[model samples]
Target: MLYQDALLERLESGLRKSLPQWGLPQDAKVSLLEISENATYLAEDGNGEKTIFRVHRPDYHTEEEIRSELAWVAALREDGVVETPRTIPTEDGSPLSSFSDGEATRYIAAFSFMSGKEPDAEDDLVKWYGELGEINARLHTHAREWQKPEGFTRKTWNFDTIIGDGALWGEWSAAPGLTEEGHAILEKTAALLRKQTDAFGAGEDRFGLIHCDMRPANLLVDGDRLGVIDFDDCGFSWYAYDFAAAVSFLEHEPYLPDLMAAWVEGYRKQAPLSDEIAAALPMFVMLRRMQLTAWIASHGETETAKSMGVPYTEGSVALGETYLAENG
Candidate 1:
């Protein structure tokens, strides 16, 4: 834990240095909020006003890609397609700033503090998931109709980028505690996914820009508003992939069927759902499971990854076996 502690201290220092760029008090009380793919902090000024500052992990996204993400967030808010946190510009009116943490230069962006807490399992999950489905449908519709700015670019989450040789998170084959039996099962599952997704094809309606990480942790519930946050992973992918992402890390839960049904019902209210795409939802979920397995292996330093550990790999194997039996 020494390494993580040291890293946090460095990042905290960087955040303090960055606050001035956004015209915030240098002595603002800043606390770490989360440390996933990025280090997020909550900064409170002397007047009690708050802002969220996100320090990007090095090498994950270029400056251009970060700007593209903010651009989309701006459009989504401006067009009333979704309720997202507004970006706070720097003193010079730039949406992003940078700080050197000695090892590498990290980009930092500030956002208006959004009010709400993440929805928990004890809540009315069915209702919340239904709302999530509708929200995703609206995002998909916007992705389809909106005109992207020139030079807009983001990563693509196809089979190759998700799990194959080009896997972004890392290869699932390297997952902790993955036995030979489990590896074989995942191999078959991957083959089946390739065949099915290839046959399904990437038509515009089926595939487009997506919020690739819409799990509940990124959702905030305040009264009737369901605010979505964390666009760090947004990119090009199958539209149905959003549902798969929504159920991340809970693929084995019993209520999943009910949740999936609610999501489909809610999504249908906003857009058409082809039988082919609907049938492929399970495939996408399995694919997401595998992708997350890879993520756990590569990001073991984070608490979330460490907590999941070998159990998550074993669960992926079990899920893969069931997927192969049902779909292979």
Candidate 2:
């Protein structure tokens, strides 16, 4: 625990140092917003002007990869494709900035504060999900047509990077509280996912750059605007994977079928959905579930991971069985 505490101290110090790069005053009231893969902070000056600061966890994405992400965000905003927080550039006019954490250099970026709450389950989730679907479809449409900048690079969420040896979040087999029985079930499920996804070939129309983490938690719903956030996971993946990501961590909800149908309806409003792609939605959902299971294991230090704990592992096992029975 001492090491973790020390790490936190360093991060706190780094965040203070980073504010000056964005011209934030030393007296800026900074409060933590969340701690997942990155540490997000809400900083307000004496005048009540607020900015959202994102302190990136090192080694996750290279400086170049981050620039690539910001590039896309700029394009998305400039093209009016979606409503999202605008990037607040540094004093030097760079979209990204960095500070020393004593141990390593951590990157940070500021954004114009977006106002909205995450859509709650009790709310009209089915309706919001329809809007979410339309937003994703529009993003996909832009991704397909936009000309990417030279040397642009972002990781791909393919079979290899998702659950295979190259799994980005970590191996599902290493998940906490995984029982031997559960492991066996997931192994079979993974094998099936591999077989089916291998056949789902990545054609230009079916696969391209996408916002890989479009879950409800990443959304901000005001009266009429659905603002998306946390594009940190945006990259190349199957178009259907975005739908799978849309339902992250809520895989077992009874209203899932209704949500999926709503999403498909909303997506069709913007672009065509082939019968083949439509049929493969469940497979992508299973893949995302397994990926998140691994994420909870590897990111156990985060509150979100701790809250999920063993129940999520067990839930994945049940979902795996259902997926296999239906898809087998």
Residue-level lDDT tens digits of model 2 in 1-328: 1226577667767888778887887667988888888888899988899999888888889899888999999899999999998998998899998887667678988889999998988789989888888888899999999999998999999999999999989999988889999999999999999999999999998999999998888999999889999899999999999999989998889988988988988999988988898888888999999999999988988888889999999999999999889877
Native-to-model Cα distance after best TM-score fit, residue 279 in candidate 1, in Å: 1.2
lDDT of 2: 0.89
Q: Please give each candidate's TM-score.
A: 0.97, 0.97
Task: Report the lDDT tens digits of candidate 1 across residue range 158-263.
Answer: 9999998899888999899999989999999998988888888888889999999989899999998899999999999999999999999989999998889899
Q: List ranges where model 1 is wrong by over 4 Å.
A: 1-3
Clashes of each: 0, 0
lDDT of 1 at 115: 92
Evaluate model 2: give its TM-score: 0.97
Q: Record all residue pairs in model 1 with backbone atoms less than 3 Å apart, i.e. clashing.
A: none
* Cα RMSD for candidates in order: 1.4, 1.4
Assess candidate 1 and give its TM-score to the true structure: 0.97
